[model samples]
Target: METAYTIRKMEKSDLDQVHEIEQLSFTVPWSKESLLYEIEQNLFAKYMVVELEGKVVGYCGVWVIMEDAQITNIAVHPDFRGMKIGEALLTFAIQLSKEMNAKRLSLEVRVTNYIAQSLYKKVGFTVGGIRKRYYTDNQEDALVMWVNVQ
Candidate 1:
């Protein structure tokens, strides 16, 4: 079910490939500097990269605190969209969260992102609530989603 991919903790050397995947996956991607800061400054943050044949194709990140794991972002290269790579990355994130003793996982998804919603649902996330004006660019509402790890 994992295809040919392997998930491992992210490293500084993964920045370039991660940037490319981020750009390809999102309308407004996080800046490389911001990512670097997260890696360097966020003690709660845990990031992982998905590799296939020794090449990075996707990544997922979360911040674990007490009983919560807050998913920050996840992305897969455009060319690999239909390969179940996103689900694999998310599974890897969830396993990492459990390893860190998190009791739950949470995230915010744009209301219009049905594809992503489906993926989250497949992984056991459920719609929990909404945040108004969650996206600055389009004033889109964000659907809050959560999954209990225990």
Candidate 2:
């Protein structure tokens, strides 16, 4: 069954939950302060959150520049995993990128994260390249996946 949820532009107040999900979902998470900067100061960055029953359950960030949009992060709360929220968030991101007039949308995912890679592949993304030692904590290679939106 599809979950009822709301996806909206992330606000300053969402930093706590967003950061919480970040910490829970990644080996090296973005700090609350950095998320605040992205919300308030980054000109090209757009952050969004997904709420389930009025509580934030996931978030995604993207930097849309000229003809391209790059996804910075996307994660669902640990408790909410497998509810399809991440896929919803990703679909929203791709649509958002197209609405922003970006011709392509891309993101870097740790090569070992087959779950996320499969989700991206389900959404028309194809492996484009690799970033050597892209993850700081484990020195893991990241696969660059991209989809043409235009």
Candidate 3:
């Protein structure tokens, strides 16, 4: 049988596992304190997690502000990369944005991250602009992408 996974709103209890995935997936991962603040204090933040076999394996975060939504970050456990979890999570974010009355959603990806760009394109995202040296880790430029959600 194929493995099963579920996507749901994130909870404080999942922080440890989410932090682990974040660390494994990004060169610059958010701190545990930062995650907690986003979940508890940030009014615009909406975060979701994908669980596989009862373990948190991936997460996506977005900030919805009035008519515009911004995708802050998305990540999957490196071992779970090929399972379409990222696609599902992004779709969920778009649907959530729609429900929140957002007219558009946008995100920034490292210029070198073609894999992520392709996935975003699959979900209807197109190039919007670019940010110079958006990533501090290696000073990589970022490609801004956006999609109409309404």
Candidate 4:
């Protein structure tokens, strides 16, 4: 049988699981404390988690500032990759941004991460520029992409 998944606002209780996916997905993961601060203290931040069978399986975060929304981070648990969870999370973020009156949505993906770049492109993002050595893990460059969501 197939498992069902649902996406909802991120809560303090979800940090541990969200951090787990962050560690699994990135070379430099954000600390759990940072996640907590974003959820609890950051006024411009919005985060959502995808739960599979009542367990957090993926998450995405965005910061809406004025007319633009910038995706801060997004990840799916290693065990949940290739299950369309990432796409759903991103799609939801886009909709949420629009509802918040954002006219454009943007994100940065590692230049070498072609799979993620393709996925972003598939969802209407286009390469806008490059941030040289944007990633501290290995000094990897990041490609900035954006889409008009309004």
Candidate 5:
């Protein structure tokens, strides 16, 4: 069956659903308050959510400054993994970054997260470097990846 979903800018009302997805997808999930701050207070933040059959299934956030856009976080509901929703979210972020005049987009993924790394590579992101002990949860190193979006 074909998967149908809508991607749109995240709003305050979406935070509860987004937070649920975040908790399901991440070992270190962002708090609802943090998401609220990103949507309502952070000027550099741009966030989007994907709704599947009217339920929020995934979300992505980025911080754009000057010519650089840094992906803050991305997650899809655990029940929705392997459905290419993460890929779609990343693609949307790239296009949004380009429209905002960002020439480069970067994000860090856990070195052990081969699935996420593969998705990033498929989207043109290359490993730029490694950030030692980048993940606070287990002190795992992170692979810093970047792509030219312009």
Candidate 6:
């Protein structure tokens, strides 16, 4: 079953929950300090959080550089999986990239994560290349994907 969610720009209050989701969603989740650094100090970064009744359930982030936007991270809480929240977050990020004058968007997903690849494809991103041993935690390769905003 699908749950109602609201997507919006992340605020300082969401840091804790976002960090928790990152830890839950990834095998080698980023550190809380690193997330704080990105939120506090990264000028090129833009992030959004998804809430279900004011509780953060998912988040996505991207770095806008010149004419390109690179997705840095995206995750949905385990309990919220299969709710299409990830898809909504990706679409929101892509739309924001266009609004920020990005001519293209790129992201790297673990090669084994077919669900994510399918979502990217559904959102019009194409497989561009592969990054060998992209994940240090498991020595897994990544499928590089891109979407032209032109």
TM-score of every model versus the real structure: 0.95, 0.98, 0.97, 0.97, 0.98, 0.95
Regarding lDDT, does 1 or 6 come out ahead? 6
Please list the C-alpha lDDT of all candidates, in the order they appear. 0.90, 0.94, 0.95, 0.94, 0.95, 0.92
Model 6 off-target regions past 4 Å? none
Worst-scoring 10-residue span by lDDT in model 4: 1-10
lDDT of 3 by residue, 55-134 (tens): 99999999999999999989999999989999999999999999999999999999999999999999999999999999
Lowest summed lDDT over 10 consecutive residues: which window, candidate 5?
Answer: 20-29
Model 4 score (lDDT): 0.94
**Candidate 1: regions farther than 4 A off:** none
Count clashing residue pairs per candidate: 0, 0, 0, 0, 0, 0
TM-score of 3: 0.97
Model 5: residues >4 Å from true position, as ranges? none
Q: Note the residue pairs that clash in candidate 1.
A: none
| Candidate 6 C-alpha lDDT tens digits along 1-150 | 557889998888899999999999899989988888788899999889999987999999899999999999999999988889999999898899999999999999999899999999999999999999999999999999999875
**Candidate 2 lDDT tens digits, 41-64:** 999999999998989999999999
lDDT of 4 by residue, 59-128 (tens): 9999999999999999999898888888898899899999999999999999999999988988899999
Task: Please identify which of the two predictions, 5 or 6, would achieve the higher TM-score against the true structure.
Answer: 5
